[model samples]
Target: MLNKKAGMIAAVALSTSLLVTACSTQTGTESQASSPSETSKPAKQETLRILSGVVGGKTPEENALFEKEVERLTGIKVTIEKPAADYDKKLYAAIAAGEKYDLIYMGKGNMDVLVEQGALTQLNDKIKASKVLSDPKVIPTKEWDMITYNGGKIYSVFNKSEGGTLPTVRQDWMDKLKLQQPKTLDDFYQTLKAFKEKDPDGNGKDDTYGLSTAGLYDIQGFMSAAGVKYKYVMDANGKRSIPYATDAAVPIYEWFAKLYKEGILDPNFATNDSGKMRELFLTNRVGMVTYWDAWVGLFNNMKKTDDPKFVAKAIPGAVGPDGKVMLRRGDPSVWGIPVNAEHVDTAMKFLEFWQSDKGNILSTLGIEGTDYTVKDGKYSLTPDGISHGMDHGAPFPNNTNFKNPIGTLPGALEGRQIIFDNNATIENSTKDWPNAEKIVTNYAFQAMMGKMPAADAVKKMRDELKAVNLID
Candidate 1:
C-alpha cells in the first residue's frame, strides 16, 4: 500500500482529471458466478450503475477502453453517471425518487445525509464476507474509522487523508538573494522583507511581493510560528474556547497588519483564492507560498516551459516564538453503496477487485512495462509513462488503492516529512462545524486589511460562535 499521504495526492490528481476517455457502447453480457472459484466459468452478466461527480470530462474512446478492461477482469459491466451540474441536488433527488445505484461517490457530509435518510447500505456484513475487501491492509485504520458510524455500521469507505500543507519557497530566488530558509518568526519577517525589496526575480521590476496567500487558512503556519491556535483551545479551567477570540491571535493579526502595511503581502490577498495565489507564484510575482506538497510537480512542469531554471523548495514551517511548529490535517473524501441497488454482491466484488494488486496496477500505472518498469523492487516510469501514466492512468472513481511509486520530487518528500514531524497539535474539532471556517476567514481578512481592529474582530467572532453554541 502507498503511504496514506502520498495516496491522497495521487487520488486528488485522478479526481481532478477523472476518467477522461469516451463512454463505451460495448455491453457485457456475461453473468457473475457464485464465487471466485466459479469466476473462470461464465455465469449471468450484470451491469452496475455508479453515480459520481464530474471533475473533468473524458472522451468516448477512453471510457470504452476502461469499461472493457474492467469487464474483462471482473466479469461485470459498469456505467458511470456524472451530472452535468447541480450534482448534490440531483444526487439526493434521484435517491428520493427511488432511483437505484450500485455505488455513489460523495463527500462525508452528503454521505451522512443519505445515511440518515436510509438511502445507503450497511457494509459490515458484506465487507466481512468479501475475500479481497475484507483485508484491512488496503484502507488505513483512521480512514476506516471515519466511515464507520452508528455503533460500527460501515456506510462508506474513504480515500486516504491528504495530510497538511507546508511552507514552500523559491530556492532559486533565495540563492539570488543570498538568503537562507527562515528558522524563526523574526527570520521569516526579514526573509519576506528581502524578497520584497531585493527583486529576487531579477527582472529589475518592482512587481513582486514576498508572499501570496488566499485567506486566514493560508496563514496557519504563521499562527503556528506565533505559538497560537485558531480553531479551539483549552482554557485555564479546562473549558473549550475559540482560540481566535483570545489574545494569542493578537500577535498573528499584528504581524499580518505589518505585512500588509509594509507591502510585503499581496494587496489583493483579501480576495485572492488558491488559483490566484498559484498564478502569482507561477507567473513569478511572488517568492514564497504555503500549499500542498503535491503542487511541486505542477509548478515544476509549468516552469519547465516558461523558466527552466525556476526551482521550488519546501521547508518545514518557520519556528514560532515558542520554538514549536503546528499544523492542521485535512478530512478524507469517501464513497459508499446505495441500499436499494440490485447487485450488492457484484458491487462489493468490484470494490474488492479495485483494491487487488492487479486492479491497483491497472488503475495507477496503466499497462505494466509500457507505462512503467520494475527493477530491484522499485518502480520507474518510462518516457511514455511520464506523459500518460502519471496523468492518464485508469480512473478509480470511488477508491484509490495504488501506491504512487513514481512519487514526487525530493523537496516535496522532505516537506511532507517535516509536516508529519511538526503536526503534533491538530485542531480538528472544527472539522464538522458549519460556518466556523468561513467566519474565521472573514474576520481574519478584515483584521489583516484594517477594515476592523483585531480586538473588535475577535469579539465579533466570539459572539458569532456563541450564537451557534460552539462556545459559551
Candidate 2:
C-alpha cells in the first residue's frame, strides 16, 4: 500500500511538474525598437514546456548554451523538466489527466499507447513542411514509421536500431587450449566440451562453463543465432490463436535441455539477468557470453578496476545449427522531438541544431576539449570517460558529421566498426532464415520460468502460429 501510494505521488509530480507555471513578463532591448507593425508577427516571445526522463546534473550549462543559441535564432524560452526512474509512472498520470507538455521523451511501446489515446501530437504535417523527413540517411522515414501510430502520425523520432550478438570469448584461454575459433556446430560442441573438461579459465578447478546465457531476453540472442524467431499468436481470418503447441519451437528446447544435461552451460541461467551475467563475466567464471557491442565498453571499463589487461574481443562468428554463421535480432531507433508547443518555431530551431552538422556533433560527442578532442581522423575520450550520465551537458560537439553513428555511446574507440561487423554477419546469415516470430516469443520466457521443455515450447509455438496462418 505504501509503495502504491508513493508511486501515485510520484506520478502526480511528474505529470504536473511543467503544467503549473508562474508567468513572467518579457523585457528586451531589441523588443522596444521593433516596428509597431511587427506587433502582429505571431507571438514573438513564448515559453515551451517539456517533460523528459533524462537526468539533469550538468544541464544548467547545456541549458544555457541552448537558451542562447535558441533565443538568438528564434525568440522562445524553453523550460525542460527531466525526471529519473519514476518517469513511466509519472508520464502515464499526465496522459490520464490530459496534462499539457510541449514535448516528451518516452519509450516506443508507451508512445504507441499514448498516440492511440490521442495524448500525443501528430507531426506528419510538421515533418513534411520541415523537409527533414526527406533525408533517408538522417531519418529512415519509412522504416522508422513502424514505431509510429496508424497513418504515420509520427510522435517521436527513432533513435537507433541494434540487434546482433557478439559472443566474446577469453582469447587467452582459447590460446592456451590450442583451439582455433570453432567454425562448425560440431566444433563448437567439442570446444564447450573441452572448456568444461579441461579447465579453461586456468584457476585449476571445474568452475568455468563453456557458455552462459540467461533465460530472459538473452535467450533470444542465443536462439536467433540458432536461426529461430518467436512471435506470439497469429490470425487466420483476423482471429488470434496461441503458438506454444507447434513443431518449429521443439528443436530449441531440445537443444537447451541437452545443454542443461551436459553441464557445459551454467545451470543458474534460467534466472540470470544481465547484471548477474555481468557479475559472472567480470569474475571470469564463464568462458563466453552473448551480448551486443555495448557490452564491450562495460568490459573495457572493468579493466580499470580488476585487471587492466583483461581485454575481450568479438570472434569472427558463431556457428548456428545449419553449420552457417548466425547473428541476433535488430532494434529500431528511439529518439525525436514533438510538435505540440507554443514555441514551435523555436523547437524547430532546436531540432535543426540537433540534426545540423553543428548540432549532430554536439548531441553525440559532447563539448570540444572537455568531453573529447580530435586526433588525426578519430575522436578519443579516456576509459573513465566523462559522464553526461546525470549531468545534462549539451550534446557532444564532435559527433555531427556521421549521419549514422553506431555503437552504444559516443567516443568509444573503434566501437562503431565493431557493431558494423557484427550487424553484417547477422544480416547475411539470417537473410534466408525463417521469420519464426511465434516460436521465438512463445517459448522464450518458458526457459526463464523453467516451466516447459525449450523444444516443446518452441514446437508448440510453431503449431499455434501455423494454425492461425502465421507461417507460409
Candidate 3:
C-alpha cells in the first residue's frame, strides 16, 4: 500500500510541473505577439512641487485649465502648495525639515534670510546656461543686477513693477463741483475743502468726505510737498538729521491736523486699511484717494454697476510748497529655488518657459478669442473676459516678475508714466532705516488726530529713535 501511494504522489507532482511550464510558455508567446511598440514607450513626465504665498487660494479644479495649459507648453506638471496662514512660518519649517520644493516665491527680506542660511541655491550658472534666461532682451541687465547678491551670486529672480502710487480723484465729482484737478498743495487743500463742504456725490445727505486715507495717511506725499526728505533731512548746517526732527515735517503735520480737524480727512482714517478706503471710494463716500494705478480699473468696473457715469482719474501727486513732488519706487516679488530641490534643472526650465514670449502671452493675455481679441495691433477684452478674466487663474508672468508689457489696463500705463516723469524729486532713502516707517506712521497719526501736538510728536519720535539707538 505504501509503494502504491508514493508512485501516485510522484505522478501528480510531474503533472503539476508540466502544467506550470505550459502556462509560462503560452504567456511569453502571447506577450511577444501582441503590440511590442506600446510596451516600449517612454516614462511619465516629471512633476515639480512649488511653495508660494501667492497661489491666491485656488483649488485643484479651479486651477485645472491653467495647469493643463502649463503642462502642455512646458512638458512639466506642477503642484503648488499655499499655506492657509502663517506662510513664512510654514515655509521656514519645511526648509528646516529638509523637505524639497522645486521653487519658492518669497519677498526680498525673506530671501536674504534663506540665502544667509544656505537654504537657497545660487543660480548664476543655471541662469546663464539657459537659452531663455541668458537673453538680454528677455531678462534685462538692470533686472539681473537687481537680483544678484552681494557675493555676486544670482539667487533669485526679481519681479519688476511700475512703482509708486498715484493720487486719484473722482473726475465726475470734480466736474459737478466745477473744480479743476489739484496740482499744488494749496490747490489740493482747497479741493478737499470743497469736496467736504459741497456734496460732491450729490446725494444731498452731507455724507461725502474730501479725502480718505488709511494707515499712514500718505504722509510721504505730504512730506514731499514740504521738501522733507524721508529717513534723514539736511539741516541748515548741511548735516543729516532724522526727518521727524526737521522743520519741514512740522508744516506737513500741521496741514494734516487742519484737514482732520476740518472734517476734510476721513474720521476713520486711523483704522481704515486699503480695502476699506477702496470701499469708501466705490460707495461714493470719499472724493479723493491715493492708491496704486491698477486700482483705477477696479474702481471703474465696480462703480459702473450702479453709476455708469462714474469716472475716476489718476492725477499726479500734489506738488509740495517747495515745488518738489517725489514718488518712491516699489519693490517687486521674487522667485527662488531651494538648495534641496529634487529637480533644480526642471525648476530652471519652468522659469525659462515662463519668460518666453509664448508663455508671457498665455499668462498675460489668456486664450485670444476667448479672453481678448486683437485688431490692428490693438487688444480688446471680450465681454466674458472683461467680466471674469482679471483673476481667472491665467498665467501672470509679469505678476510673478517675468518681464512683459502685457496685462496693463487702459490708461494705467500712461498714468504710471506720467507719475514717473513728475515724481523726479521724490526721495526714498528713508526706506533703509529699520522701523522708520512705523515711527513715522505712528507720529503722523497722533499729530493728525490732535491727540499730540505736531512739535511734541516730532520730539517724542526723535527721542524714541534715540532711545533705540536708531538716531543720533
Candidate 4:
C-alpha cells in the first residue's frame, strides 16, 4: 500500500513539472513571435518619474494637449507627482533618505542649503555639451554664474530675467488726493497719511488705511525701499550687519511703531500675511501695499466685484534718501535631476525637451486657442487669457538659466524692471549677503521673531554684524 501511494505522488509531481515547462516554452515562443519588423515596430521609450509643483492656469483639456506634446518630444513617459503644500517637507525627507527622483523644483531659502550639502550634481559639463543650450545669447553667463558652487561647478539654474515684490499704490487715489508719487521717505509717509484720511476708494466710510505691508519682520516690499538689508544688512565699509540693529531697520520699525500708534496703518499689519493683505486690498481697506505684479489680477477682480470704475494701479518707483529705490528682487528655483540617479541620461533628455521651442511655446502659452491667439503674427491673450494669467502667475522669466525669448507678461516684465532699477544702486554696492549658515550662527533669529524686546534684539544684531567680512 505504501509503495502504491508513493508512486501516485510521483506521478502528480511529474505532471506538474511538465505543465510548467510547457507554459514557459509557449510564453517564450509567443514573445518571439510578437516582434514585428524593425521598420514596422516602434522603438521602446523610457519613463521618467518627475516631481513638480502644482501646474496652474491650464484646464484639463489644455493640460492633456501639453502632455501629448511632451510625450512626443521626450519619447519618455512622465509620471508627475504634485504633492500638496507639504511638497518641500516630503522632498527634504526623500533626499535625506537617499531616495532618487528624476527632478525636483526647489525654492528660494532651501536651494542654498541643498547646494552646500553636495546633493545636486554639477551641470556645467553637461550644459557645455548641448550646443542648443550653450549659446551665450540663449543662456546668459552672468546669470548662470549665480548657480555655480565651489570651484565654479554649476549645480542648478534660475529661470526668468528678474522678479521682485514691489510697492504699488492706486494712481487714481493719488490723482484725487492731489498727491505726487512718493519719492522720498517723508513723501512716502505723507502719501500713506493722505490715503488714510481721504478715502481713496471713494466710499464715504472712513475705512481706508495708508500702508498695508505685511508685518512681523516681513521686510521685502517696504523695508527694502529703505536701502537696508531685508534679510541681511551690509554697511558702507562692507561689513555684514543685521538690519534689525542698525539705522537701516531701526528707522523702518520706528516708522511702523509711529504708524501703529497713530492708526494710519492697519493695526493688524504687524501680524498679517500676504494673503490677508491681498484680502484687505480686495475689500478696498488698503490704499497702498507692497505686492507683486501678479496682484494686477487681484486688483482687476476686486474692481469687477466691487466697482468697475475703481482702478488699482502700481505706485511709481519711490526714491530713497540717496535718490535711489530698492526693489525686492527674487530668484526663480528650478528642478535639478541628480546625476547619481539611475535615470540621469533619460532625465537630462526630458529637461532638454522641456526647454525646447515646442516645449517653451506650450508652457508659455497654455492651449493655443484656449489661452491665447495669434493676431497679425503677434501672440495675444484671448478674452479668457486674463484668467489664464491669473491662474498661471508668471513663468519664471528665465528657464533653467536659459533666456526667455517669449518675454514676460507686460506688467510683470515692467514691474521686474522697476525692481531692478530700484536696487541697481546696490548692485555691487554691498557684497554678497552673508551665507545662511554664518548668518544663523551669529544672529539669533528668535529676537526678530518678536519674542524679545526690540532694544535687546538690536544689540544682538550689532554683535552679529562683526562676522560680515568673514567671507571676504
Candidate 5:
C-alpha cells in the first residue's frame, strides 16, 4: 500500500511541474512577442498635498472648480485643506508630526519657527533655475529677503507686497456728512463721532459705529498714533524698546478707552473677527474700518447693488503726534515646501506656473466667461466672478510678465503709499512671539475697558517684560 501511494504522489508532482513549466513558457513567449513601444505607458501624474488657511470653511465642492482648472493648467493634482481655525497651530503640529505636505501657505511668524527647525526645504537653487521665478520683476529682492534664511538661502517665497490694515471710510458717508478728510488723530476721532451720531447711510437709524475693526489689535494705525509701539519702539538712536513699557502707550490706551466707553468703537469688538466685521460694514453698521486694501474693490463691487453711492476709499493714515503714521507693510503671503515632501519637483513647477501670465490670468481673473468677460479686449469681472474669491494661491500676485487686466483697484494705490511710507515693523524679536503678544493684549484690553489706569497698565507690562527677560 505504501509503495502504491508513493508512486501516485510522484506521478502528481510530475504533472504539476509540467503544468507550471508549460504556463511559464507560454507567458515568456507572449512577453518576448510584445515590443517596448507597443506596451509603453504614460508617466503617472504627480499629486501635491497643500495646507492653506485662505480656503478655510470652504466646502470641497465649492473649491473643486478652481482646483480642477489649476490641475488642468499645471498637469499636477493638488489637494488643499484647512484643518483648523488656528491654522498656525495646525501647521505646527503637522511639522512636529512629520506630516508630508508638499506646499504650505504660512505667515512670517510661523515661517520663522519652521525655518529655525530645518523643517522647510532649501528653495533658492530651484527658484533660481526656474525661468520666471525669482526674476527681479517677478518678486523684488527685498521682498524675497522676507523669506530668506541663513542670510542668503531661500526657503520660501512671498506672493504679494502686502499693504496693511488701512483706514477705509465710506465715501458717501463723508460726502453726506460734508466732512473734510481727517489729517490728524483727533480729526479722525471727530470724524468717527460724527459717523456714529449722524446717519451717514441716511436710513434715519442710529445703528452705526465710528470704527469697526476686525479686532482691537487690527486697529493698528490708531494704536501707533500717540507714538505707541505696536511692537518694538525704535528710537532715533536705533535703540529698541518695548512699547508696553513706554509712556507713549498710555495715550493709546486712553484713546481706545474713549472709543470703547463712549460706544464709538464696535460694540462686539471682543468677539468680532474679520468675518463679523465684514458683515457689520456690509449691513450698514460701520462707518469706518482699517482693513486690507485688497478688499476695496470687492466690497465696493458687492455693495453697488444696495447703495450706488457706496464709494469706499482708503485715506492716508491719520498722522500721529510724533509726525508718524505707523501701518503694516503689504502682507508677505509666504508659501513654502517641506523637506522630503512628495512631488517636490512638481510642486516647484506648479509655483512657477502660478507666476506665469496664463496662470496669473486664471488665478487673478478666474474662468474667462464664468468669473470675467473679455469684451473688445477689455476684461471685466462678472458679479459671480467677483464673489468667487478664486486666487488658486497667488491672490495678490506681482508678476512682472503679467499685466493684470483688472489694473489697480480703488484705494489700492493710497494703501500702497501709506503702508510703504509708514511700515511699522511689528516685534517678533522675542524668542516667544505669542507670549509677548498675549502679555500686551491682556493689558491693552484692561486699559481699553477702563478696568485699570493706562499708566498702571504700562507699569505692569514693563514689570512683566522685565520678569520674563523680554526687556532690559
Candidate 6:
C-alpha cells in the first residue's frame, strides 16, 4: 500500500536525523585561533550542536537570524535539530549510538537515567564558577536546588517553570448575567449558579453550563481555592503521602458534588478533553475553565473574528473558606550536556549567554523587526508574532533579572504576582506511584458525580492505592 511505503520512508528519515559522525573532528564543535602577534591571541571560534526534543516554530531564515544573534553575542555557533516524534526513545538511542551533542533538551524524568549512566556532564562546579550561571537572578537557588540530587551534585540546568494558571472566564457572560467577579469560594459558587439559571448566553434554549474542564483535576484552581492539594506531600521523616486520599480533599469533592447536583457543572466535564473544553468555552456553552494566563490573548485571537464582542480575561484566584488563596506551578524544562561532548567550555559560554538579559528577550519576544517593532518608545507585536506564539527555548526564562520589552500575554505579569502573593506550590510532575493517578481520577469523578459519598470515595481511593502498594 502507498500509505505503508510512506510510513517506512518517514521512519527512515527520522532515524537518519539522529545520526552523527562520532569522530572528534566531526563532533560539530570546532575552535579556531586568531593571529597571535606581540599584542595577544584572541582565540576560539566555538561551534556547538544541540539535539533538542522540544520542537520549535521558525522559518529557516528566522531561526538563522536568531542563531546569528546568539553567535554574535556569545562568539559561539549553535545548531539545533528536533525530531517531530518519539523524542525520549530517539534521545536515548542517539546517546547510545555515541552521538556527541554538546547540549541536549530533555525532561526531568530523563535526569536520573542519564545521571545513572554517567551520560551527562556534572554542572555543580561549572555553575559555581561561572558569573552568569552562579547569579541568583539568572537562576534562583530554589530552582537550582530542584535539579540538585545525589548528595548535592547538579548535572543539569532547567529553564524557567511555566507560571501557575490564572484561569479565564467569560467576562461577557458574567456582565450579561449581572454577576460580579467572584473573590471567595462561596462567591464563585453563587456566580456559577447564576450562569446556570440566568441564561447568560442569551439563547432561549437551556444549553449552557457554568464551568467545564478536560478532567476533574483540570479545575484545580477551584480546588486550590477550596484548600486542596492534589500532589503527594513529603514529611520530615521522609514518608510520602497523597493529599487526594486525605481529609483535606473531602470538601473539594463535596463542593463539586454540590455543583453537579445543581446542574452548574457540565455533565461531560469528566469525559471532555482539552479540545472539547475549549470548544465549549468558545461556543458559549461554558462560562469558566481552568487555563493558563496566555489564553486571554489566544482566546481572543481565535474567536474575535467571528464574534466581535468576544472577551475572555484571566481573574484572580478565589479565596478559600480557610481565607487563603493558592496556585500551583509545574517544574521547569531541563537541559544538559553529555559527558563526552566536545568544546565543554564553549557550550557553557553559550548557555550562560542564554541566561543574559538580551538572550532572554530574543528567545521570548521573537525578532525585533519581524515579530515586533518599537517606535517613539511604544512597543507592539506584529500579527506574525502572535501567530508564531511564544514557542522558544525559554518562553518563561529562569532569569529573574530578565524583563520582556514587548510585554506579555494579558494578565501574565499579574498572574506571576498572584503566584508570588499567594501560597503557591509546584507539583513534582516526575513522581508517580504506578496506577495511583488513574485510581485518583476514577474515585474523584465518581465522587463529584454524586454516585458515591465523599467519604466513601476517599476510602475506595485509598484501598485501590494500597492494593497497588502505592500507599500503606
TM-scores, one per candidate: 0.76, 0.68, 0.78, 0.75, 0.84, 0.80
For 269-336, candidate 3 gives per-residue lDDT tens digits of 88997879989998889998877665676577666767988988877766866576775433345679
lDDT per residue for candidate 6 within 270-378, as digits (tens), equals 9987778889999989888876655565677667668867778777667766788777654445779899888788778877877888667666766677777789977
Q: Best candidate per TM-score, number?
A: 5
Candidate 5 segments whose C-alpha is farther than 4 A from its true place? 1-38, 55-58, 232-241, 368-370, 373-383, 389-392, 424-431
Between prediction 2 and prediction 4, the one with superior TM-score is 4
The numbered model that scores best in lDDT is 6
Candidate 5 residue 113 C-alpha distance from true site, Å: 0.8
lDDT of 1: 0.66
CA lDDT, every prediction? 0.66, 0.51, 0.65, 0.56, 0.69, 0.71
Ten residues in sequence with the least summed lDDT for candidate 3: 1-10
Residue 344 miss distance in model 1 (angstroms): 2.4
For candidate 1, give the lDDT of residue 242.
Answer: 69
How do the residues 353-381 of candidate 4 rate in per-residue lDDT, one tens digit apiece?
Answer: 55555555555555466667777777776
Q: What is the lDDT of residue 468 in candidate 4?
A: 55
The per-residue C-alpha lDDT of model 1 at residue 201 equals: 82
lDDT head-to-head 3 vs 6, winner: 6
The per-residue C-alpha lDDT of model 2 at residue 408 equals 42
| Pairs that collide, model 5 | 162-330, 162-331, 163-330
Rank candidates, TM-score, best first. 5, 6, 3, 1, 4, 2
**Higher-lDDT candidate of 1 and 2:** 1
What TM value does model 2 have?
0.68
* Higher-ranked by lDDT: 3 or 4: 3
Put down candidate 2 lDDT per residue, 1-472, tens digits, no spaces: 0000111112344324544343444433336768655543233355667665542223556555544444444345656665544666666776565566666655554554465555665666666676554466655545554565556567665433343445666666687789888755456667767777888766788888877765433344344345543333335574433222344445555655666678877787767766677678778787777665545555655554557656565553444556544344333323344333445554555554455654554444444455456787576663213443211222222122354232343223333354454433222111111234424444655643357866656566656556655554
Report the C-alpha displacement of residue 38, candidate 1, in angstroms. 20
